[model samples]
Target: MNIFLVPYTRWRHLAMALWCGGFGLMAWWLVLALTVVGGPKWAPEWDGPILLGTIAAFVSGGSILGEDNLRRTPILKRLLRGVIAVVIAVANTLIWYWLLQLVIPKLLPDAWSADAADASLVSLRYRVGDFLAGGLATGIACAFVRKFDHVVSHVAGGISSALAAGAAWYLLGSNFQGLTDLYLSGAALGLVWGFLFGLITWPIPDSLYTGWIRVLSAVRFGRRIPVDAPDGGPKERFVGHFPRGLDLFLPADQGVAEMHVSVAVDGRGRYAARGLSLAPTRVKRFLERVDIRYDPRRPAPLETALSSGDRILLGEGEHQAELEFIMLPKEEM
Candidate 1:
């Protein structure tokens, strides 16, 4: 039996994961601060009406900005995109809270007492609803700012909204019952945090997106034929099982020889392949090193065979040579 592994490479995916994970950690810390550390110091005063309004403002503002920054869209588009994001986030938060309320107590009865569990369940629902309303309102406010037609004013509005939201959350802590409410209350807290944090971090997505797009565009390569024989005859093609777009090409006449192929993109964005032939090897050894780049765009299969040579340029014209070749896509191999 023979096993082949395909080479995979995608820098964009890695960058996106890192960016999202980094912000997620910060969001977690904010929740911990408001619920565990601040406690009574942040709760609302006797004027419930004023406190509630403040909380609403912060929650909505944070949610709008946070989601907009993440999506790499202009704040001016907040009405459409921000509202949609808030609805989705709220729905997801509510579903998560409801599921946890039903499943958590049973899973860890010792962790939560009967009365504590009941209070938590109720508190969670209220927190989810409050956060949803806040997010919606904040998004609406941002929509108005979009009409201003200046980046500076838009940013100032975002900053003001975030500060207002944060202050609101700090004053209305009583609306959220206790630590049990944290799970549901976290979204509301996120609303405030997102608004403030989002304003501060607003420029990040633009810069990051610009840099990321340039790098990806530079590295990308279009489909090209991998030729082994000049005239193109009975050639063997070997494919690897990798789903990503990576392949190798070996020309005929190098009997049982190995090749070291290094691929890179030039300033022009064309993929340049440098092939270095290796010493003769047994059947098993030959199979280990040799791989192919399977391109779906091409009508014919691309295959490569190792030969006795120091280095060979793939695109350079060479005389036709008779050779047996096998073609296989990376995934199938």
Candidate 2:
């Protein structure tokens, strides 16, 4: 059988591998610390949260790194900033978990360990609980670490695989269990469990994630105002290229005045308008406000439309008006 060590380019794969390895080791260490220093009695029960929090911190750090890189920030400076951000995240997690531990004793009396003797059953149940709790914690963490979702997912998968392998080794012992037998059994069980778990908790769609980011960006930076048309009529229509599934980002109060506006349909498709128009330059400035989407499949200069109410007229035209517009790339619109 052919083995595919890494799928992406060498540099990319190396960077990803290093990031994952570093983060995975951090997670392992955190788990170990919780068990060893935090007290094993509580460790077994809190293992999921500790590991999940560690993963969250890694992802949050990676996201900060990625965002800095995307904004054309210097690599060395970005790296330093990311490291600082990660340290803060780690400290936050530790504090949060510590507080949770304090609160748990007051809330639930039996939120801790079970002294069951059936080794296999206990491990199996603990594993299942860990998987569920870890997955949930990871999902929540993903919300904060949106930029590094792909990397985080890959790292999480790798760590989970390693843990499974360790469990299998413990189960089979040193007896010359055929390597092939071990691999097949392990692979099968992993697949079954993964599939079952995935079915139970469906993942968030890519579009929804992007939409949330866009909404958050808008809230942070404020909305874009477009340039008005020459005739002084309200610039009721907005047209722009936006990422698919981001239509949710469009405000609901701003009705879709029209569908398939001629400007958008002429050559490149344009997203319809909804909001107000300010100045053309302001529109351009607003467009640059955030990384709306990251899709390589589409073209450049994505467009965004504005309503007549939003338009700030520069000059009137016989039929044409100077309107503020954001040219979004086909990929990001």
Best by TM-score: 2
Q: List runs of model 2 lying over 4 Å from the truth.
A: 1-11, 33-44, 63-122, 143-333
Question: Where does the lowest 10-residue lDDT sum fall in candidate 2?
Answer: 207-216
Each candidate: RMSD to true structure?
16.6, 16.8
Model 1 spans > 4 angstroms off = 1-8, 40-72, 78-80, 95-333
CA lDDT, every model vs. true structure: 0.35, 0.36
What global local distance difference test value does model 1 have?
0.35
- C-alpha positional error of residue 293 in candidate 2 after TM-score superposition, expressed in Å: 38
Compared with the true structure, what per-residue lDDT tens digits does model 1 show for residues 75-161? Answer: 577566545544443443344434544565575556554533444343432233333333334334544434433445444543454
Go through the candidates in order and give the clash count of each.
Answer: 25, 37
All candidates' TM-scores?
0.27, 0.31
lDDT of 2 by residue, 193-220 (tens): 2322222222322211111012112222
State model 2's lDDT. 0.36
